[model samples]
Target chain A: MLFYDCSTAPNPRRARMFIAEKGVEVESRDISIAKGEQLQPAFRAVNSRATIPVLVTDEGTVLTENLGIAAYLEARFPEPPLMGRSADEKGLVLMWNAIAEQQGGAPVADALRNGHPAFKDRAIPGPANHAQIPELAQRGVARVAQFFDLLEERLNESPFIACDHFTLADISTFVFVDFARVIKMRVPEGNTATRAWYEAIKARPSAQI
Target chain B: MLFYDCSTAPNPRRARMFIAEKGVEVESRDISIAKGEQLQPAFRAVNSRATIPVLVTDEGTVLTENLGIAAYLEARFPEPPLMGRSADEKGLVLMWNAIAEQQGGAPVADALRNGHPAFKDRAIPGPANHAQIPELAQRGVARVAQFFDLLEERLNESPFIACDHFTLADISTFVFVDFARVIKMRVPEGNTATRAWYEAIKARPSAQI
Candidate 1:
């Protein structure tokens, strides 16, 4: 398998941390997002979406989304499962992961893309360029603040976002929370549960990458 | 299982169709989104997110996300699986499904929420209200158009979005494309592959509900 990675991006980092945790090796290709390499013809041939963290499988199938890559890797490398082991665990893993993506990841992107002048006309992802809306930045920031509280509430109830085991839910959430630094958001000082959870995930060796 | 449904919303419709396809009958409670029922304190207690299509599992776990409900149902009733039977198929199913949700579903939502007056201050889904950005609606329409091209390209390659099977990928794409009508967008006349795929999914009995 060949993994298309972007060291600076949150989505690719999620895949990277997952791959590190599983101890699986894949030929890596770096696509610098800041250099506009993802939109280049070479990368476009691999994924028309023009997104990073693509996994080209041994069978020649290209998995463009993180969920696909994770599922395939988990299936192939099951010793240290990052998704989940049981039916209930799988459901919770997917659920929390989606929540982290939508509530946390999306808001961070919104706050950055819609607010930053650097992302002017490039608010939305993909091949098309979209003009930013300043108003969206405020909304994004507000949503992210709420997301931090939600993370705290969830963490207070369970050890990990999904439950006892550290699964894909934690990986995605950890990456998103860490990437939130770009939007100037962090685990609030009062959010002890979320702060502790973030620290725990950060201490993991897989997070070093 | 008790399924909280909304006949008008796309997200809930995905779960409803999945349930219909599986032939697993759950006691359905219609939460009319048009009536702001999702925001009621009663529904808020079920899901803090205040979203519809929540499944109260037999074990009393509240499955809030569509993936969660699908995973739970797929495990309990494996026949005519909406995800996939094999590992490779599951990976492809999830991969395509995530693309459908992010690329297709999110765009339709952006178009509607950002443009429609009824959705004013509700641009983003969740417990909080977000003001609409008219500019985002235009960007959304453009993104949806690109999503259509992507769909056309994918459908031309395989019988279904993920491949030969009609799985969660097809369900999500179908619901999002159909919901795009509210934003005054539909499959372009030139996209024959996408048009045919739409017709095929619509013909399914599950789509009727």
Candidate 2:
């Protein structure tokens, strides 16, 4: 398998971390988003969407989305299952992961895309030209704070977002919480439970990759 | 099961349509977002994040995400097989559903939250106050276009987004495409395959409700 990767982006990072967690070895090829290489014709052939973190399977089938890559890997490497072992566990993993994506990661991304001067004409993803909106950044910052509070509350109830065991929920949430630093949002100082959980997940060997 | 729903929102509408598709009888309680009822202290007890489309199982476990609700319903009512039957089929359903969530549905939401004035101070989904960013709306519009093209391309290759069968991928994608109208974006006239697929899915009895 050939993994098309981007070091700076959060979504690609999630795939990379998941692969590491599964101890799966695949050839990695860096796709430089900072250099606008994703728009180049050569890269577009691999993925017309020109997004990073694409996995080309041994059969030459390109898995273009993060969840696609994760699902494929999870099914192949069922040990230390990141999705969940049972029906209910799978549902919980999907639930918490979606929450982390919608409530945490997305808000931070909106703030960056609309507020960052680097993305002045590229507020959205894909091969389109769009202007930025600075006001959304302010809103994103506020939303992120609430997301932190929500995470803290969830952590207070369970060791992991879904339950005592660390699953894909932990993977998604950990990436979002870490990515939140870009928007200048931190885990609240009073959120001891979340802080401890974050630290514990951070210490995982898979997290380092 | 009791469904905490909102009539006007796209996310909740996805759940409603899914339940309709399943032909399941669910008692739905409206949580009016326009009235700020979701943020009330009373509503927070049902869901701390205070978002709609929450499902309370007969066991009283609160399922807060769309995928969560879908998984619970699919398990209990397995005849229709909204997820999939085989391992490969399951992977495809999950992959397409996640793509619809991230690539299709999320951008429209970012556009709405950052662009809509009604969401002023409530740009985020939680109980906190945040402002809107007008620039994100432009980005969102562009992303929606790209999403359409992506969908068009995918539909051209297969009968559905994931596999040959109509699964949750179609359900989520159908909702996202329908919801895109709020952003003044519609299915492009040139996307014949996607248009045909959309019409077929729209004709389903579940889509009417």
Instruction: Please report the candidate that would top lDDT against the real structure.
Output: 1
Off by over 4 Å in 2: B23-25, B75-78, B85-89, B110-121
Off by over 4 Å in 1: none
lDDT digits (tens) for residues A1-209 of candidate 1: 89999988999999999999999888999999898899899999899789988998888878877898888888788878777666777778889999999999998999999998888888877888888888878888988899998999999999999869899999999999999999888889999998898999999999998
Per-residue C-alpha lDDT of model 1 across residues B1-209, encoded as one tens digit per residue? 89999988999999999999999989999998889999999999999889988999888888888998888788778899778666677789999999888888988898899898899989888778888888878878888888998899888999998979899899999999999999888999999998998999999999998
Candidate 2 lDDT, tens digit per residue, B48-163? 77888898887777888888888778777876888776655666778788778877887898788878878876656766666665665666777888889889989999998888
lDDT tens digits, residues A33-109, model 2? 88988889999999887777788877666777677787777767787788776556666777898888877887788
lDDT of 2 at A129: 64
**Candidate 1 clash pair list:** none
Highest-DockQ candidate: 1
Model 1's TM-score against the true structure: 0.97
The per-residue C-alpha lDDT of model 2 at residue A182 equals 80
